[model samples]
Target chain A: MAKELTPQEMLRIDLTPPNKDWMDIPTVIKPGIYCYPAKPEKVEIVGMPNPHVWSPLDDDWGLPEDWKETFLEGMRERLNKHRSFKIFMDICVRCGACADKCHFFLGSGDPKNMPVARAELIRSVYRGEFTKAGKILGRLAGGRKITEDVLKEIWYYMFQCTECRRCSLFCPYGIDTAEVTIIGRELINLFGLNINWIQEPVANCYETGNHLGLLPHTFKQNIEFMCMDIEDFVGVTIEPPFNKKGAEILFVTPSGDVFADPGIYTLMGYLLLFEHIGLDYTWSTYASEGGNFGFFTSLDMAQRLNAKIYAEAKRLGVKWILGGECGHMWRVVHQYMNTFNGPPEFLEEPVNPLTGTKFENAKSAKMIHISEFTADLIKHGKLKLNPKRNDHLKVTYHDSCNPSRGMGMFEEPRYIINNVCNNFYEMPENTIREQTFCCGSGAGLNAGENMELRLRGGLPRANAVKYVHERFGVNMLSCVCAIDRAVLPASMEYWVPDVNVCGVSELVGNALIMEGEHDRPTDLRGEEIPGFAKAEGEEEVTEDV
Target chain B: MGRNLHKGLREILVHKKGPIVEKWRELIHKSYPPETAQFLKREKDRFSNPIGSSIEDSIWPLFDQLIGEADPSTTKKLLDNLVRVRAVQDFTPASAVQIIFALKQIVRKEVLPAAQKKGLLREYLEFESEIDRFGLLAFDVFMECRERVWEIKRNDLLKRPYLLAGGMCPSYMMKRGIKHLEKLKKEITQH
Candidate 1:
């Protein structure tokens, strides 16, 4: 609501003859549109280089006198080291195929948020400093020398991007804008500028073996507390082995599953599911978190934190790893982990111990998603499930950004949901599966200060859910990511007030007819289990696995 | 006041509500790029254009409230539905509520000739005063919505410190649960 350009006074941008000098018009790096900077102490705790303190709103970012040279030097180093970075910088035709694909652009209607324009922010810097054609032609060749304002503009939009890679999917040349953002962020971090959301978690994960910085004792307490809930609800006890050496598999998941609500329910789902299947999996407090927040900050930081997972797996003598539902974690596990800190030679391929269904998709990474594991379980009829128990929820699935586009595991989640829930509806074809819209709050942009930005980015996704909510009475939204569980509830509150956001596991927990479990009358949150409350009042319902 | 002024004004404003809404939509969407504006300006199909369709949906009900009943509760209800949405947009309070002024423009364009020809300037002035009153009411809704947005932002700021310290996205668990239950209760009874 702070005043700036009124609607009538703002410049109207049009698709015109190729503009030779894009920098002639300064990008409007608006006030509320940017993120707060990282606290230097947190950056230092993670042992990152140049951990100098700065805030985005300050007049000066406390850069060293040689900050520009440092950025340029880092750019040169990356150009030499990563051929993909050099080629991505060199080869953009700007056909604008990716312009409308970005949720940030579609939601905010900001020209700079467009994928093409966002890439141009750093691409311009690349041309001016690195290319001969740019050095001679300067602004004529889409190049601009870096300035204080230009640095701020670059940092501002880099954080704005969730790096969901939906844009990369649409690029005809497949010029990944995410690659530009990754290296662009790495170069910018040479001077220690990072959003607190990303840097703080990186620091926590480095020191405490988890993003939430839960001590080993406290982490165990959280799991035990959930165990109590499971005992009271199901009349069955679950004592998950933690840091137990010689366990067959290492069970790792995002710590948000332990700390946040509804997510806690899904954690309960894992405990219940593992207990039911009698899988010999062990939880490790050392590699307490599966999510890699460092992946958003810098590659070195990501590698530093991700080292804990494989290190813990080795120390525990586990054969393979099974990951819980998360988006970016899978992205790192599937795409970057092996390249960064893998070959994980000590670990074996993931095979479902109960049914021995080998996960071919994760044979190399030695990790399998819980949905794939559970879908195969249901396929082989290893565990009991009651589709009627979840009759109350006419549900729709939100494909999280990384798993859908980054790994392409579309039908695994849908297959599980269809088998568990009676009424399931897909969002519009364009907004589901591979072409799925973001939860609008991925990649550590799920901060509270940016609620307006989050809401704006969420409009397209919420609109899609609302379509199904109105048409099919879908009061529940199920997803596969802990970030979605943390952020989408707030997004739903603003956009579609009636739809409740939850992890797919919460629904699975509700519907699973576990061994030695009591008759179910309520859901994870103690909400009346809709139609079941009536059925239970009149008749005792019992099912078996 | 002319004998037929109110009826003719209603005919002009109400009968031609389609163009009035279209003109209002154009004014509302003038800020976005033309291509994006096309999406935001779609008057039908809530799925394709939820925000635009919601804005368009308020048009007739608001007109009925403004001219026919002029009840404060009814006016507040219609405008609050739209104001809550516009509050979150990247615009100042003045600019956000500026959409309501489109009503005055629509009245001036659609009924000015009829009112002048009927020599009902007194009745027309009365109608203009009513719009001014509703405009003031809209200003109130806009201020309240802006305050609510800031309130949410302030609460977020308080909770964000914890997220920084421990990588938590904080919210009032009790409040969220109650909100979920309230909506659930409403849904159950409604069905």
Candidate 2:
């Protein structure tokens, strides 16, 4: 059952700002709007502060005895440590350019979900405590004390943000809301408060080297299981090397690829592509997950989980790392990995063996996104592609936020998609590339109780997809993010029913003509490939769309 | 009781149609942020003010469709653009469809005085059922939209139960289930 918000609340068209102070406008902490709390044990495992039973929906979340002091102190430390925090705090002109750009604000119509307003949630607190104007002229200076209402508002709106940074792209000062939210969330986590969706994965990634907490044997068996699918469907025997010593490259992918359905197909695509080129890479159970869920919470957690990739690569004696197609993983590995983990002096810069092209951007880090690798291979005419195999799919590409905005590797994915799929249509120019809307559930906010919020926040993305789907007869929404793979399917189902969601690599697997493969009568999902059934001398039924 | 309630309901639906439509549109328009709402509240042009246009398209036709005749297709066609926007909004099924019933409230306030004055209780009662029927139809559209929401979720789950199926710890069992489904799909397609 959907929780009800009055039409006046959701769609009130009044233009005037309330005469009352913002904090004076009462905050209703709605159920199914916020995530469940992290278990105390999980908080303990991560050694995060304020480990205790609590709920965001409750009036009194279990907090430290001096939670206010702790929060202010933590804010002070973060402000001193990171200059961006101080600058972002002081520099907001609140021009409102970034307001309508947010998918959450556009979808839910919650004014605070707007980037400027969301930033103001934290900025207000900063104004009250840190700034002189805020201290003296509190409410007038947009300063609100860190009261329980403000704290609850912080939890509600901060988690609501996907940290997609679409707002930053439009900001006159390039003020990244993700950085603000990241610091804001980290400050919140000082109370040992984290949502289970984020904390559980962070805990699991810490303990099991992956988010799903797959045991070493279970991890190995899962990869082997997908290989069997390849053998059965494609008739290609792919013995993907697992922790093989002295491999040329260490391939790290999000464990969602190995565990989930559409993502598993993408994982299969990686294996087939690797085997096709006789890629010198090994899959490490230790460095299995490329997605750093800790990234959603704090930089320290991201650093801890990301440490596995370089450690395993060093141990395996691999030259460089070839990252799988994932969203925030690329954001982390490309931007934050080197800074947090270190200069991996052991691994050489990523090189395409066929084209002998060195990835100069990844020279210091020595890691390249799989799209970059695949596009280079395709450009050099390395792998034989049969694009017509994907003709059944009138496809549209969803640019995952982090990679498109964070790394700006915009062309690489489209290049691969165009090469692999024939009937590809770009989602509207404004919605695609840098100005992309989040799938509404990035940053580990994909839990079920919050499904209504997720669906609402996802409307802009879904609406854009609907335009392409209705116009181009687009049936598939493809992206490079595992979170998108996990969440966009639900968004598509809710908004645009006929369209399906998949990873870009899943398209690659379908179109790829494997060496010594059984005529892929079906795509990796076992659905009949459009024209393949008719060609197989079966009843010439209308091809499944 | 039923006769009295029906008469009371009808008095509003027929006599107060104008105010009812105005109030309903006002509520829908108010759904946007204050700035957007202020412009949308006044903007009369359909092109410049699509929200205004949508209201004109959905509400006026909706009133005629409900009060004039039982043309479901024409009514649906008229309301589809407007309701679909609401359907995707961050609304509960109740709130999303509740806008449909705001007319009934306006009908009560506007038509009640006239019905009592004219002693047209019987005639007024007839309009009551008519608007109820429209409310039912509005519910039908809302439910269908909601059903599609759930259907999309169910269909996605059906497409790949593997999301929940995995981490259940029996690796071979999940594989067998996948293999079984693949074979079933293959057989169905073959047929």
Q: Which pairs of residues collide in candidate 1?
A: none
Each candidate's chain A: what TM-score? 0.94, 0.95
Error of model 2, residue A277, in angstroms: 1.5
List per-model TM-scores for chain B: 0.72, 0.63
Clashes within 3 Å, all models in order: 0, 11
Per-residue lDDT of A444-479 in model 2, one digit per residue for the tens? 997766766788778778877878888889999999
Which residue runs of candidate 1 sit more than 4 Å off their true CA positions?
A1-32, A531-545, B1-5, B14-18, B33-85, B126-191
Candidate 1, CAPRI quality class derived from DockQ? incorrect
